[model samples]
Target: MLEVEQKFLLADKTALLDQLAQLGATQETDQEQEDLYFTHPVRNFAETDEAFRIRRIGSENRVTYKGPKRNTVSKIRKEIELAFESGQSAFEQLTEMLELLGFHPLRSVRKRRTPFTCQHQQRAFEITIDEVEGLGLFAEIELLAEESELQEADNAIIELAAYLGMTHPIRTSYLGMLIEKETQSGSD
Candidate 1:
């Protein structure tokens, strides 16, 4: 599936929440997520614009692979994710297996996320308000769609974002922003 998403830095969480409520959006269970990103032994994922990460939410673990961005306006990419057994031991084993195969841990991104579901233009969009550790707050509007539905999905995301008064969309991933921040800090 393709992940058609637009992210924005949020200035006021309460205002956004009020807008969502007006749209009849329903809240989902909030979650604390830590994503451990990895580097391939032989390839540079950053240069290739790809990402491989293991995300841990409570006891559940999921491994996701995100392909390069397909568009310049939004974060349109191919994403494949698989869930593993839910436990510390299982998570460790999976990490060990990846390490054994030559994948090296890069960094971890932690965030508290609250998600809402709303229907717009006949599509269900997953909107997440994230409080990213060290990176401030962000809101993402995303829709998962088939390859053939890319344009429609992108349009829906854009329209919804505008409707919510989100003017500028940030295309940078949270991981990328964190890395850049760390680099700048180190240089300072």
Candidate 2:
């Protein structure tokens, strides 16, 4: 399925949360998650966009391949699983498979998600409620679907920002930004 998701960087969590309460946004679940994304084992994948990931959050272990949709994606995956271990082992081996497919690994990011309880919302824009860890109650509005909907999604985000009295609208991907911070701190 085509996915459209965007992250809104909020400054005042408490204030916006209070506004959310006033707006009738109900609390749902309070689950935390720690995510770790890895690259496919294919050496050439270092330059491609395909990603083979191993997500370890709470007690769940899921291995996912976020690569371009290929005709034999499922068939190839079944062959790989039957030939190797599951979870991390399978993820590691995916890199090798990508190599055989003439694809290369590209970017890898690890983000810890702590998503708060978010019931369904009735807003003016299209939103995909992200139940992640570390970040609570994320509003992801993907603009990748109808390229034209980009402006509409942006406007909706702006409205949400105003309604919730939010600030610090971050543009960088959280996973990449967090990793960069950690690296900078370590080097310093």
What lDDT score goes with residue 163 in model 2? 56
In candidate 2, position 181 carries an lDDT of: 71
Number of residue pairs clashing in candidate 2, backbone atoms closer than 3 angstroms, sequence gap of 3 or more or interchain:
17
Error of 2 at 20 (Å): 0.7
Candidate 2: segments with Cα more than 4 A from true spot = 1-10, 42-52, 61-148
Clashes of 1: 0
Provide the lDDT at 137 for model 2.
46
Error at 71, model 2, angstroms = 28
The best candidate by lDDT is: 1
Estimate, for each residue in 75-176, the C-alpha lDDT of model 2 and write its tens digit. Answer: 011101122344555555655665576654444443434333333233333333343333344444332334454445445555565555543444444455
lDDT of 1 by residue, 61-177 (tens): 999999999855778999999999998898888889999999998999999999999987788999999999999999999999998988888888888999999979998889999
